[model samples]
Target: MAKPPARLAASPASVTPPLGAKPVPFLAAVGLGLALRFLVPIPAGITVQAWTLLSIFVSTIAGLVLEPLPVGAWAFLSVSTAIATKTLTFPAAFCAFTNDVIWLIVVSFFFARGFEKTGLGQRVATLFVKLFGKSTLGLAYGLSVAEALIAPAMPSTTARAGGIFMPIINSLSLSAGSKPNDPSRKKLGAFLVQSQLQGSVNSSAMFLTAAAQNLLCMKLAAEMGASIVPALCGLLLTPLLMYKLFPPEIKDTPEAPKLADERLVAMGPMSRDERIMLGTMAAAVCLWVAGDMLGISAVTTAMLGLCVLLGSGVLQWRECLAYPAAWDTLFWFAVLVGMSGQLNNLGVITHFASQVGNQLVAANLGWPAVFGLLNVAYYALHYMFASQTAHVGALYSAFLAMMLATGVPPVIAALSLGFMSNLFGSITHFGSGQAAVYYGAGYLTLKEVFSYGALMSVVNLTLWGVVGGAWWKVLGLF
Candidate 1:
């Protein structure tokens, strides 16, 4: 089973929601689904078991949206509900944990936690800035490239952008006479923050371990016998797009090199942990990219790398156990995968797919025509979601099924939906964890962030969808 999409928006400062935010709408959503299960007529070819699972799935999604409980809690309940109703047994409910996808992400999280504890994340960023901070545009791309370099080792964009890039970017903004309330605010601060936000998401999409949700999508694609196309199409174009879209007042940033040099010198040489982290990540990525040819799965290589880190004292076992976000992701992703797998086995997904096919046929839509419409609808759904992972978890699988119904191949559906999951973060400040941190920096007002976010969404989609998609087609991804 593929993993559940993770905390695509786990922020550095984990803010709790208001308790008084009513659960009434959530309850209504679940109740309405329950009514549909009994009142609505099931078409002839569908099984009662499948229809029941669909109702439960709908109610579960409502609970996820309403958040009367945390996302993980809803996942737990959904799996338990399947068991209680004999939709699946306990082993079936728990089987997703045994799958390779779940463990790959689990180990990836441990590797990331090592980066946080060892100060290795900062070292990577500072090194890139020191080498590339010769000009304003160059410095911005430097930061972007730095994020991309370390993205393979870190799963949390919030942790990557918020924990590492946010502070560094803020200081860089101030040093360039671009403080929040000053007249020079527009000079570099806004551009820097926007650059960070856009850069993080695109880089996150480049590698499987770059973002938590990427791994989930990878699993789904692999399960469908589809390739994820480990190509650099997005990376090749995203920086150029940012260079064109986000221009600053100043060009030659002579002061930036001096600032970065001073900071690098003050920090001194890499610590033992940082050295180990750099080496471990380098080896891990090589294996991940070539593992299939070498007869080693990505999960096997990742787990071995993690064991080396732990045994070498770079990351302690207790620290890995205590990492809450990783644990949260494990619980939710595992259960959600189990539930989704069970639903597919029970024919609920097939029935749902057939229904969608009928509707598209009625509308006289061809496969490609329906696909473009669905892509836009999928991207637009990001407005209702605060976390990219949540949006992916709630919609990705079912919608991918619908894409299949359009007579499109699974690989096409998988890549399209997977790419959209990360790009959705570019649409709103609240759309992703990194977006939240960048927006909170005060360089851009809410309206400005949102407006620019919307603009960048179009730019990113065009580059990725048109340019990147053409490249993937060359690789036979479609």
Candidate 2:
């Protein structure tokens, strides 16, 4: 007799949330804006228009945090409200779309897509594993090195860690009998997962082009008369720091190199497309590193590289148009940047900074003490943030303003806050997209995530705060 038809599992809900929006957070955000607009008295030397803009900006930030609607939607609505209320002219509200930094980031996303399409990113990771997978610690370092190498070209941390490296890690773990949710998990899987996540975080901190928000931080810093140079101290120290903090159960993995070797052999050789991508990336990096001295802007360098890809047919125009993340970023990024610039123009940020600085100045603390306290607070505050870009957008400028008002050096204050923007992602599973990806892999327990994340925050703060301070001083950055 034939068996009865089997029952099918239900389909999961769509990844995209519906447009109808959640009510509680929505009401709370709108209420906060209205309360601030009506209840709070305007401070001395601030106009009603500036105060109104501040209320709208605050509401938008709250909406971003509560996420009653998609971030882009919130940004769009905020801009629209600003125009309708006559707080800003249409041209003034849309001016940031012409920003060079915005285009640099958008084009860099296309560069990242080239890395993904041509498989160069995967090849780089596989080669590193094959070269350094003889021991568990060695394997960790290998992955860190690969992440640092590709990070400048790949702006999306999730794409770099989750899409490229995680697959290799999963395969290696299983090959060595370390399956998730089983007795053998601790043997190799958990350690590799944690190590890669930490490594990616540090790599993101090391370069300006490594992450989208780093560019945002750069643009904001420039507005405050500070120039942020990429710092190498974090990248050099992160892997070893993580190893000491979170030691793996399996100390040695004799089969790891062999496994990596098999994968590399199967990948055969670099294709023509990868070669083109590599040359384009190399040219772009060289230009970016020396562009200022060579009279070329970073944006021009990125555009030049992107044009090469398009001209050579390495990436089609159609593919570039289809990249949702790049376009999505361009839209919301321009809106937030324009609004933030207007706030600065209207003197809201400066006024807010001076008021806070006056109180902190009364404490009679040294600049170093003030910076240390502010830095720690800034790092800890990431607990309340889910997106690094949003956190930087909302707080980085204000924090830098306060630091400057208290007599902190421009480069030091700017670079410190910028690096912490990436480092603090290690503090929580939802702190950033990459963190969510690693946590969701199920190799780590909740206790492990929090404990290790907290410890790493301390280590990262000390490393960047003390050692990085000394390094920057030596380089005359201060």
Candidate 3:
């Protein structure tokens, strides 16, 4: 009954407890908003309300980055400021509470809860290990397959990687004599850790529901008359790419499948809850895939699945309320979406885009060349960010708007940036929630994280840019 690592002790969906606020960062955040509101002259084309809202939005993003308060607190503050300042009316400020994309993400969190509660997620990972755990590389692929299979229902990448897979990965590495901080660390732990971390990033990019920001990206893309669907090209290539870039010390892991088999046997057959959970997940996926044809929205499909789980006793209503991550996500996501949508409506985004686009236009580059440059710039900028949701909230709309203004095709501009929102999470130890989980395990050194992260970033950009671009063309998305 030893305690788990501090990072792993809390519920997977629980918010990190706030350290007492830093007075300097807190003042800096407020100062930034005030400076933008008063000191900076409003551009001629932007309305006063738009200027006011922009100031609040910028401050909120700064608060997120600086951590003057918890993310949910910052979001709540932003909504209150907007309403109090008369920048947005009550309904206008809270309209995104009913947003379908926001609900879809919230519901998906419950889906993840069912997976964790019923132990179905663990069962799936072990089954894959039993099938493909004969070698280190094979084990990485097996875990990647499991990651992709469950990603759509799991919005929190941290929950998927940290809750289900990390424990099992720790067991496998230990049994193979690959303890962290020991000479044998590189034998299996280092390679598997990095491989699965990158694999999670790839899976996140492949599905709109895999990470919360993805649904935000989708809603933003839809504003520009472009749509994003599940992507398979990158998910199919991640394992092989990671194997080449970060080769494991132990080429063969003979004990992995045996370990997996033993664990599976110990768990016995899938219980009633697991079986019902599995069926609900399957029906949800099918409905989501054909949702447009069936005239059902993705959110509607997710709600239906949640209802089924509730009715079948797989998940109780009290448990859903106790799930802090879902409610926290709902609050922050709705506020950000509300403000972002209002910015679009007020032409703040368009005005900002035209200002930026004019400079790029002056370079006299073709739209293709502009796209390449902006794409790289956007992906590389993740080093400055610690949260994907913050980056998207602060920059995604503006960048997408600039691309459109510069005459990039709608689908290419919108969806390319949308996917890159998740892909860039591969770049840093602090890049996303799951990145922190893997890095916190004390397995990989700082040098290893940076070096492999950079390499994987390059590979992802190339694969998605060339291969994904070609695939989209064939599908007539462009």
Candidate 4:
């Protein structure tokens, strides 16, 4: 029998309340926000604030469409428009294509492909499931922990957690008697879904090397003349935060005494792929940490890793090209970078930044309060963005400028904003790529995703308030 199309699948906003359920009113609210930006006019010059708001609108429009092209593509288009309009120059338009951060993303794909092709990823996943596979929730923790452990070595959070872990979780949940279409299984499936997404985001955030944007944040910080040491600072606190913020569920407890035997047997043994991946990954990590010591750029180190994998016949040239997301990601990032250059060149960003900065100064705020305020505002802005790289590229400079104008030290302002950029993804499914991946896993409805994400945003903001203050004090940044 031909199947009837699912109502949710057929409609826009399938995972949430139907568009008509709250359509015009919701859109009106968004329109109001956009209108508010124009209420207090700023002088015309390259302004970060103007670009920030425009980026927000673009991101919102893109997320709603869910087109085959990712958010990054739209980002490119926006930048191109800025250039065509004389908002940016030719050199700035193309600079992102050559960015070190962009190269890091490219080379990481080669390494990831080599690892994935080996089928070793499945063995590792299976072994993890065997250890924690007895209960539904145990599987969640196992997958989450495994991703966290591997994130430092694997630059692609989507590849490590979303690509690798998500499939295993889906199959295991099905194997454990959670039927995919069973209405009763919805809640359980949703929980499993959240577990994987949360794990990916949390683990990715823990390591600077975990996501491309995280590395970009480090580079951007360095460009601003701050020494926050990406390798040293943020990761130490990741595991602790993951444990505290990630909740343990009661339903995931095993009904029978769990055994490690069958899963162990089913996994067979590791192959050449496993050993190769492990070696390559280990070598990559060493290079990442020791790159500065070895007098090499991180991009060079990433290229070397790619070369090792390709030259060794571990991953074929065509195979590397076939990995869709890597190139796709690059295109999007390049576009965003171009758009940023345009915003700066056109003088739109500067004008907007001045206006916002003046407003904050007039309010007579201190540094810490300004930090908290900007942090909240940025994350709140994420509700409209589906791409973190695009959002960060488009807005970081303007917001950073605003913070500095408010008497915050440049170093403190830069690093805190960089950290908050990654932290903001927890606000909505459309806030970041990883968040979207979680929603697509078919477990979480839009409402559930938003609820948890919003809650986590509050948690993160509170943590930022306390931890950021101490870190500032420790470093004498204030």
Candidate 2 wrongly placed segments (more than 4 Å):
1-18, 132-256, 365-478
Q: lDDT values of the candidates?
A: 0.67, 0.73, 0.73, 0.57
Quickly count the clashes in candidate 3. Answer: 0
Question: What TM-scores do the predictions have?
Answer: 0.60, 0.64, 0.64, 0.60
Give candidate 3's error at residue 151 in angstroms. Answer: 9.8
lDDT per residue, candidate 3, 1-478, as tens digits? 9988676566766977567667887899889999999999999999899999988888876776676776678789889989998999999999878866557556766776787678886787667668887887888777778888888766657656654566556556765667766755655787878888876876887766778788787864443212222245556566676677767777776787899899999999899999998898778667665665688766787789889999999999999999775687677757776787787678776565556556786796988888877777678756655567766876787788778777898877878887888888766655666665566555776567777888878787887777776767777766
lDDT of 3: 0.73
Steric collisions counted per model: 0, 0, 0, 14
- Per-residue lDDT over 186-233 for candidate 2, one digit per residue giving the tens place of the 0 to 100 score: 547788888887767778877777777888887545321121222355
- Per-residue lDDT tens digits for candidate 1, residues 254-308, read 6665776787788798899889877887786676656646887667877888888
Ranked by lDDT, top first: 3, 2, 1, 4
The lDDT, on a scale of 0 to 1, for candidate 2 is 0.73
lDDT (0-100) at residue 279 of candidate 4?
81
lDDT of 4 at 306: 70
**In candidate 3, how many Å is residue 309 off?**
1.9
Query: What does the lDDT read for residue 60 in candidate 2?
Result: 76
Candidate 2, residue 363: lDDT: 88
Q: How displaced is residue 451 in candidate 2, in Å? A: 14
Span of 10 residues, lowest total lDDT, candidate 4: 224-233
RMSD of each: 11.7, 8.1, 9.3, 8.1
